[model samples]
Target: MQIIKLNNGVEMPQLGFGVYQIPLDETEEAVYQAIKTGYRLLDTASVYGNEKETGEGIRRAIKEKLVTREELFITSKLFILQTPEEKATETIQYSLDVMGLEYLDLYLIHQPYGDIYGAWRALVKAQKNGKVRAIGISNFKSAKMIEFVGLNDVKPQINQIEINPWYQRMEDQQLHEKYDVQVEAWAPFAEGRHELFENPILSEIGLKYEKTIGQVVLRWLMQRGIVALAKSVRPERMAENINIFDFELSKEDIEKIAELDMKKSAFFDHDAPEQVEWFMQRMLETEK
Candidate 1:
């Protein structure tokens, strides 16, 4: 696995397994299979309601000798409802306890809502207390990102966002670069939207590298220094996703793929008022 150093001087896997919506019961098996398939980084979040199972999977993998605790880079995010310093700190501990881990490889403020300043402060405190190795945020646009950095003593080390050939996020990438924050792609395949798996251009580029379209997309992100997360419950797909390290896409091929950019997310736009309302409702439900 290739490694990237965070601005805080921590090493992270350039590629990882994300358990975004993986079923709770199946998460353990999927994570176990991922570990057996050579994936060392696992991303989960409190809102997924599967951190316990994710932890169970890691324990199973370790018990079976598939991997060790130290070899794994475990990540989880704080929910939007838990942004206050007290609530955020408690939530972080809850995740750690549920995962049965002493420290997380990384922890992030999951969204750009609620009391983000307090939430970031909580994360920074956790980092100082050694409960987390690195701190960052997700789904934050450029303006919020800049405000976050300006307000905090420790700048965010990573910005996890939607990035794929279809939504290249070139402007956002420039902003992340300007702040020395690493860009980590959430939906690297655009959640298979735009028939990403069947794209002719990507397929043509993959042919040159003897890779699949998914692999080609992942390699493209990695080439541009983005940490890419490719999630799959299927063992075969999990293995296939991580096998991208062996091949390299040429500059011309990458440029060709760049032309496929539509500069938008295939998923929801957090900046939209309706989307914000929906997220607010989610927060309310979580509070209940």
Candidate 2:
């Protein structure tokens, strides 16, 4: 229910639902359940191969009057394309059609690879024409964000990156602040990487608040002003994730959780060459 204003003055929810690895057949129901559980922000991507189902979920919710289209914040991303510069518009249209929406609340460059400038320009154009509400990028680190923001006419409103107890990017947080770019955290639980859920630090904090470690982590991010994207298929978990607004993490608790910072992703590096090659291969596979 809390809103963070982007650089362009667009408002985004503090906590959101993501559909990264959710199976296609089940995505609609998961999304529908999330909406019913009071999640207004839904994050998906073209590469996730479930936009149609995600859209169907939104449609079912709207039809049942669980929530209206305007009440929800929808987001999807542009994937690595052989020639994104040329195919960007078409790809954006494909997401819109499959998602059964005229415009997206936020559209991001899934990765900083392949014709990014061209894709970003296309997104900027989409924003001007009302195809998307706001535009940004994902997996973009500080250095890339600095150069990208300096060169582009429109600055990125949100830079979603890896942020969790084990791999907290505190230094990157400072850089985003300098540019007035809001940071949205993906994998806030680190996908349970680095044994995040079992950590004594987070566990101790949770015990004091009578909350789960997941709730503690989400509350940490919310206090830091980072929009946290948490994915869950269960209705109870969805409700718990958004129920973080009631309690506040004290300064001492935050500092204790901060000690658990390992300062790097448990997953592979996003800007590394091999990672780039891996995503490029994915692009080929998807296109094929």
Candidate 3:
């Protein structure tokens, strides 16, 4: 596994397994299988409603002796409702307790809404107290990222945003690099939008390397120096995703794949007003 050291000197796996929308009932087995198949990085979230099950899988892997706790990197998120200093602290403790872990390898504010500054302050405190190894924000675009770095005493060690062939935020990535913030790519495949798996360019590159399009996409992200999170319920696919460590993409191949960029998000726009309002409403509902 490739390891990237964060600004705080915490080393993380370049490729990871994400449990975003996995069903609660299946999360345990899926997580366990992922571990068995050689995945060391695990990503889950408070809103995913599967932290307990995800923890079960991790513990099971340990009990079975497939991998030790020290070898794995586990990550979870602070939900929108938990984005205040008070609630954020409580939420961190809750995630630790529920996930059955001593400390999280990384903890992130799941979204950029709510009391982000307050929540970030809480994360900073958690890092100081040793409850979290690294702290970051997810879905934060360039404008918000700039603001956070300028205002906060401790800048985020990472900024996990959407990155894929279609929505390649290269400019924002450069900004992050300038601030010494590592970039993590979530939804790296664009969630199959525009038939990413079938793209001629990617497929051509894969054919050249005797790999799958999925493999090519992940390799591209790795080449761009972005840590990528990929989720899968099947063990075979889990193995395939991590199989990217071997081959390298040629310079010409990288350029051809770069031409497929649409420079937009495959999902919703995080900067839109309605998107912000909707998240606020969801937070209120969750609070109640």
lDDT, model 3, position 24: 93
For model 2, state the Cα shift of residue 37 in Å. Answer: 0.4
Residue range 1-288, candidate 3, lDDT tens digits:
899999989999999999989999999999999999988989999988899999999999999999999999999999887888999999999999999999998999989888999999999999999999999999988889899999999999988888999988889899999999999999988888999988888988899889999999999999999999998898888999999988999999988987998888898898789878887787777665
On lDDT, the candidate that comes out on top is 1
Per-candidate local distance difference test: 0.92, 0.90, 0.91
lDDT of 1: 0.92
Clashes of each: 0, 0, 0
Task: Give the number of the best model, judged by TM-score.
Answer: 1
Clashing pairs in 2: none
Stretches off by above 4 angstroms in model 2 are: none
Error of 2 at 90 (Å): 0.9
TM-score of each: 0.98, 0.97, 0.97
- Candidates 1 and 3 compared: the better one by TM-score is 1
lDDT of 1 by residue, 125-223 (tens): 999999999999999998899998998889999999999998898889999999999999998988899899999999988988789998999988989
Name the weakest run of 10 consecutive residues (lDDT summed) in model 2. Answer: 80-89
